[model samples]
Target: MAQNGTAESGATEERPALPLPRPVTVQEIRHTKVSERSTGARLCSCSSSVSSVRLQLCSFYKFGIKCQFRQKSKARTNTWCSPQMFIDNEWRTSSRGRTFPTFNPATGVKICDVQEADKEDVDQAVAAARAAQQRGSPWRGMDSSSRGRLLHRLADLLERDRLLLATLETLDTGKPFLQSFFVDLEGSIKTLRYYAGWADKIHGKSMPIDESFMCITKHEPVGVCGAIIPWNFPLLMFMWKIAPALSCGNTVVIKPAEQTPLTALHVGSLIKEAEFPPGVVNIVPGFGSTAGAAIASHKDIDKVAFTGSTEVGQLITEAAAKSNLKRVTLELGGKNPCIVFADCDLQMAVEEIQKGAFYNQGQCCTAASRVFVEETIYEEFVHRSIENAKKIVIGDPLDPQTSHGPQIDRQQFDKIMDLIESGKKEGARLEYGGRAVGEKSLFIQPTIFSSVKDHMRIASEEIFGPVQCIFSFKSQKEAIERANNSQYGLVSAVFTASMDRALSVSAALETGTVWINCYNALHTQTPFGGYKMSGNGRELGEYALAEYSEVKTVTIKLSETI
Candidate 1:
């Protein structure tokens, strides 16, 4: 459990208020100079007894980083964090000297200005990665054990700075702070450590041919990989790409999603501190059109790994084909389904399904947007699901008691609302919650719609919000058919007690991954990806290593050698 009153199991809890900021006037506090950084930046710090709210500002001639500071009475909390791009193993601004601001989705306030990478910046990063991949370069020459040492060191640093990293992620992405810390950050640490252990363990194969010739296969690092990560799980997506690539001894240029780049930039600092050779890993913060496109189409990049929307995944794939024919792997969007049989534990199914549909504000690609229930228990399941949805706490992500936060920004908020409106127009019964919470933040009501038809937009389209659509199915065959009707094949879930049914349905589903009695369960040891329009390529486990490696076979004749 965290000292901030968070539960070990990541349940919401009540806690005392320490430093929630009150609406203030200018007279409340004035800025006081703290010190100057070597970068010619002045640090301004202020405090006030009028309220717990404080302000800290770092201003340079050409750059500035501003942050809001609050306190947990004795413990400190940072509201805004400094953001920078990591390239050539150094913190830098863009070549064009342009920056874009990112906001706290929970508060709808701009938190910090992030450096925006354009074409030139992407080119520089790609060139650096290519250089690092060259023979005799530090990263290329390093042994697998040495590479693993750096990754483990980086993991240790991440654990040491876990609180700060989680805070930054919560502030930037509007996910619950505890969830960010325990789930995203914890997953990242475990993933890095897991890949680190596999560094020296990656092996090739040997074969003897007809006793006269010897043949061997070697798995070498794929040169210069480009990874474009998504906003939903910024830090975790980052690790998902770089961890396996580095473990396979590949150099990388990563583009963190522009909306949530802070935590990735923070990890950038750790990468430098861990002393990874320059260009081994570079973090570029920019929009998908510019930085992301450059990565996907860059001729020098040998491989590209991306996690984003299905539309963008197609663009990346096309860009790869139009360029140097780079190897590509993508983990795209999902419109997942969760089928509940009458034999399921009623209470357990309701609770687990709620988490699947509402966790991370339902921004997860694998969220159970479409839930089909056995017709016999349809009424009970709907009522119980509504009850569970009502219990979900929605507020500021920093609050320990808040289980749900705002959507990423205005665009996503509008999209979710539009989908909700369409559901009503299409005649789905709104059981509860179908409006925006307030005018202030980007919060939506945890919505549930019953009597949904399989053909409705709310049922077929990926509504990446805290909205659940319930449909009734008469038989197991009907449930499977309805679930597989979508264009996506990312994931699906089944809540049933019968072992025979679990296996039968799980095998019949058209998804890349299936949960027999659970939902939203992800592990570092398991392979994860999508099928069909969902995406291409797997992300985790030993299978992921293949995406970042190239195999070459060599044959030798004993007589010829002599």
Candidate 2:
């Protein structure tokens, strides 16, 4: 194998040869902050003369040197603030006395330790949520308008601290900071406000009954809810579940993924600052087996909403059924297909495919992982995708210039490599980027494999990494067949000039969401979920609010005089 660059002595032999940047200093970052913002925010400015030059140097150094520099420099430490778990109106720790380390994926270093809740902790949280659902609980008795107002207040808090939240999310989840700021944070705020407006407006219709009777229906909270969030877009997923649930008067126990728990914990503080009653929202950060399983099977939980892998979703579903058959809503794995036709704008399609496959390091469930290109454009598309993939900057998430960062952790990084190996072994041609990047950080190159068959694991399974598998099809029927071959069907995209073709292909596709001429476009007002093994139920918009609520029917007899 040819090396792109040379590695320093003592660095891991498997480390990428790309130049590493120098260690960043807290003072330097503070200085950059002061210069960027005209405001006198009392930032401790670094003495470094050039920011880009320092970044380049930091990028080339070995992991050991980087760690040593971080220890010596204040700028490299974990300075972002995070809140503790709130339970029963009090901030507390796990009853079983356990904790888990939360790492910054940008550098694969522990930023802090979050309290790991055990079964006892899950029971306590459930009890607290159940109590909050009772008649006298602040959330239960509050008028709908008041609930809306509280939600709006939370939105305001989030808006005011948007920068803080975005930084923490990027640092923890390895997503680009700017992307998190504009897409994730802004989207979350808008989602909350949108649902807040519905707090007082959720109403059911009355139906005509027999001559002597009247029938009416109402929607009520499902009571206590258990929400299990995945690592990818942690804060945003939390908002997707919590906003509508709280808006509909449902108290919730949120279990954030073990990999990225800081932002969720911080949101707990925001909830308190918004003046929401303590038991109305609780966050428990722990391992999937301990906290997530307990939440899924808890008898007191009236409903369970989860976002994760299909395998995990299945386990949660079975557990929920075994335990009182609690209402379940799951948004699971997606092997979404992006179909490109000969007549489509090849440049636009290439860009969309690049973003769809590699955005957030391909951790998004709805990411376009499979590509079915008409035979005429297959070669060109594969070539262009490889060219674009090579240009993507892969390094520190904190760097605004970095387009792609590391994966969530070492395990995820290894899993992606294993799958890439599988693709190569299965006879798929490795077009580009089938290797890991930086030695210390869990960074994988944005990879692409062409000549992939429909049955290849890379094409059929969810790699959930920055890997794209390309296959060629001779006709639209073949494309549809290939797209629907996967058991998972969450979202898919089609790029074609023919409106009729787009419509026909979209209709034939089995995914719940089909985007034409675009990929990964989402809105808070639109309902999102998947069909088949992609899990059940819907989220976002008014539809998500319904998931947290139940229907109650009432009947009245007309007066005999009538």
Candidate 3:
């Protein structure tokens, strides 16, 4: 390996490609936060098998850090302000002087207070974004190549601060520390680098026309962009909104979900460290009703991108239409499906479906909430799924060995418990694991319900928790129909050994994205969105760049034939 994260041949070592250097395991992370006192551990022996959840560990496993564990934990430390808003590359107290506390969901304790941005704070942020995007400003006048270089620098800063960012993420959201580090942190870094490569590549094309006339189409920035991110994957959503918008030469005023804002706040300081022009990116942490409403209705914000519930998505659309009719894109709620055929690889189906259903404690919008298994193998699949769910270790998120964590808060916990109760009332077979795990905190047992009917509330509604409902189908047509019979059309999976069955069923499905034999496989290189009421527009890939841009047609009449 090279010193600067570049590949070097003749080193005789094989490792996964990464933009930056990372430690071999969670134990190697030298920070003194959630994870306890570190002990000396051996270098990797190249025996750690790589998985989706261990993307960071795959890079240089030969340098082992030992089997990770905790001795004691200290107070939280960070590189940014908590009780102030980040605007114009500076941290400032809210003009309204109001502050709100963010909690550690795993412990049910308050982490710290954060500035609460309402309409006043949002106005200031919007003004800053507008100023930064003005024709003569540093951000607007900078060369596209320079813009790309800035994004690259930002990625580097994020990589350098990856440990702190992951700690903050787990501290605020109650996600397992390994998940915060290997999955969410790695995903965010990859997204930033991907968009950085695209910063200078966005271009317009000439049009064919008469010899005396010339025509061309240009993709221009949509000016100031307003982003309202969700709490489930705060840091990932934060980068998803800003990377493409910034690459397209647009300024952004982002309102991260108040429930989880620490990582976003830390990244705000990172934006400054990356040497981005002042006001190019602003972060205001507050409630959706206040800061979110202001951004949706602000005429100065040229476009808005939001990720949340379908109901909230509707409100944003209404607010946008009632104001300046600014362009908008939404990544919203989903009750996605997975169909397992009789001939499918039974073990793979169970594992992938469980992962899709339970990862992030099932807070994902693309969670595999609904599963339609062929009747012949439905009972066995359900058995294997319950066994797999039993392996999840639920406890303090800071414990690297813990695979499951608490719900975001009391409300989410209550909602999930209520849905489980509803499933029992609706006569679904409670196969295994229901109810809360521990007292005080918000940990819910990995729940599974078989013999689920399509009309059951647990089957129909977006539970947004680690609960899986399995429905059995008699035929291929029935399985496809049952999977398609939902208000949401976000993503779906079909598990079968036959390629013809995979292709045919994938094509017939009404979802935006389809997985052949896998589930929840997302890449920054591919676009992801929904088909029906799930929401409009896409995130990630070349498709996301379109959401932050405007197409203008230029035509000229030639003075004379050339």
Q: Candidate 2 has what TM-score?
A: 0.86
- How close is every model to the real structure, measured as TM-score? 0.87, 0.86, 0.87
Show model 2 residue runs off by greater than 4 Å.
Answer: 1-83
Ranking, lDDT, top scorer first: 3, 1, 2
Q: Alpha-carbon error at 135 in model 2, in Å?
A: 1.0
Give each model's whole-structure lDDT.
0.83, 0.81, 0.84
Which of the numbered candidates is closest to the native, going by highest lDDT?
A: 3
Query: What is candidate 3's lDDT per residue for 315-420, written digit by digit as tens?
Result: 9999999999998899988999999999999999999999999999999999999999999998899999999999999988877779899999899999999999
- Judged by whole-model lDDT over C-alpha atoms, candidate 1 comes out at 0.83
Q: What lDDT tens digits, residue by residue, belong to model 2 across residues 78-116?
A: 222223455764556668766677777877666656667
TM-score of 1: 0.87
User: Worst ten-residue run, lDDT, model 2?
Assistant: 52-61
Candidate 3, superposed: residue stretches over 4 Å from native: 1-82
State the displacement of the C-alpha of residue 537, model 3, in Å, after optimal TM-score superposition: 0.5
